[model samples]
Target: MMKDLQNKTIGVFFGGQNPEHEISIITGEFVIAELRKMGLKVIAVYIDKNGIWYSNKKISELKFFQKDYAKKLENLSSCYLDLTLSRNKLVLHCNKFLSRKKIDIDFVFPTFHGLYGEDGTIQGLTEFFHVPYAGCGVYASSVSIDKGLTKKLLSSLNIPTTDFIISYRHEFTSNDDSLIFKIKRKLTFPVFVKPARAGSSIGITKVKNADELKVALALAFHYDTKIIVENSVENIVDLTCAVLSDGSKIVTSDVQESVFGSSDLFDYSMKYLEDGGAQTGNAESNLIIPANISNKHTEKIKEYSKHIFKEIDASGTIRVDFLLNKKTGELYANEINTLPGTLYHHLWEKTGYQINEVLEKMLLQGYARWRESKEIHKDFKTDVLNNANQLKLQHHSE
Candidate 1:
């Protein structure tokens, strides 16, 4: 590992337009704190509910973001990543009269949970700028964010996954009865309706009958244009495993079983609003570490978790959720979170690695990946532009 990153300036981006905005803030703050403790120069980048990007040193402290910081906004500056090849920097500009300033960020750690932040948008920006950033790349983020797409891909690969049906907003508005009828005919009752491209259980509902299904679909549609209705596993238990990938080697953490307190399923409150919520331990949904399961089952989940990490081409840290059918003894891959809450550091800690250790490793790995990318041959030996001109002449003759 590289000995020092003292000179490097790292940007921690958190909060977004999605429903999980507050949760993202907490996650971002936690990461910022960790980076600071490591004696590194950290920049706190906040994305508000309006999707406006701002940078402020005050953001490094949790108090500054507990409520609306409108009064303090004047001190902060609006910023955007400068993707121009000339520089891999963050451009912060405010008034037209003031000259624009640029901050060179050695690395970016995105803590945004859903939508634009975690769904490859931020990663795409970093990749386009040729900057090193932690977490999954564009392809992995895009593939894992869409629940319907994840199910299809996993099922196609012969990976166990619950059966699901997808519905678009237009189709629902045009013919609700048709979509409802198809779902009922294809799957049994007690299904889950969720926004296809959502996280933190922001827009999810459990439906026991057709009437409830309609209501759930309406709620889910409000959050996303596309919705997914999946067969709910009976007498099921939720399990999650964290995966960390560094180049060729991939490591999976101990399995965790999430137990709900007041709800039958893990919802938004259980995930973010509860005691110590996602920032530290269990949160509202008490998580059992090294999940109580047979040794064989434990190994199976870990194996599947590692496989999904590789299959998605994921880097950095990823949390893979699993659902086990109590009656059938079947374990199904639920979803992959490219940027899991708190980076699932709690799980890793229980598995023998501290949060800081993981973060440092990830930073080094990200830098190495960036350096390796620079060595790749991007230009072709053949003169493609000249050949294109000849092709144009040939096309004119034809």
Candidate 2:
């Protein structure tokens, strides 16, 4: 027990300057909603697209986000990024309101996705502030969000993944034909190219031939500087397995497959708010709960997901994606979402854990991590402050 966090203010942080800002809101609101249901005092921290922060009672409502809604937020309290050891507590920069109104966060649940939000910058702030928060620590969040880093780490661990290659903007700018030829030679046609540091299918493209590779690269490069090209999994079922960790052990969720629309390639729209208007099939997109896959495949995915979670030193929960080619039965682990969509509670809900229980579990995990850090000894006997004069004298003598 962290002693201070019991029934204290739990901040559900969401939104950022990333393209996934709206989706982040959806995820953040889910967490906030669940926390409220759990009887926890929750604070909704909204980071505007321009990086401005806000935490107000009205933020709890979903429609506060309608385009002309900026005016509605006029009454909401504004927050600023101090970039110091003060992430948990947002200081009221406005003097008049500073005295009476202050938001002190006892805990943080960062539901922000992509770029600065989930890329370890916010996690670093929480670490500096020494506050309990849910999701992976700084290091894990950093590696997991970076595609190149994740592939390297997973490859080093001897995990099976799709064949791929990286291309630098400089190389592409040079109009390197070898890049295309090399990709075609090593991997078959129908390649998957994505921005190395992006999420939510923002910059993912499936190319049918060498001609489309260039266009895909250009599109993906618009989102990220680095390019990760992988072999497309034809006739494959894309699955996501969410794993939760509490240090002692990690638990796995039943494998859930993504059922895309008519477009063989699942793009941004198919990902978030499926445009097919097929709500019935969406039920299939959800977790199968004790997935219908063979025990061998389930075990393999579960073990792989757990290993990736541990290899990344991931805390809280992480959703690891995988592609299993139906024809060949070849399994390749895809990217890991450090701050997975909606905390992936839907998958866990099948295990008798309600949204409230999920919130509590995540909170407990966050506090446990914070408490573990406190257990580490960092005291020093020497008085460096008092010895400043002696140090100056020694430097002068030297």
Against the true structure, whose TM-score is highest?
1
| lDDT for model 2 | 0.78
lDDT of 2 by residue, 294-383 (tens): 778888999999988888888878889888887788888988998877776667776555666566667778888888888888897888
Q: Model 1: which ten-residue window has the lowest total lDDT? A: 88-97
Off by over 4 Å in 1: 81-86, 94-101, 282-285, 381-384, 387-398
TM-score of 1: 0.92
lDDT of 1 by residue, 148-200 (tens): 98999899878898888989999889999999999999988889999999988
**What is the RMSD, in Å, between candidate 1 and the native fold over all Cα?**
2.6
Candidate 2 weakest lDDT stretch, 10 residues: 275-284
Candidate 1 — what's its lDDT? Answer: 0.83
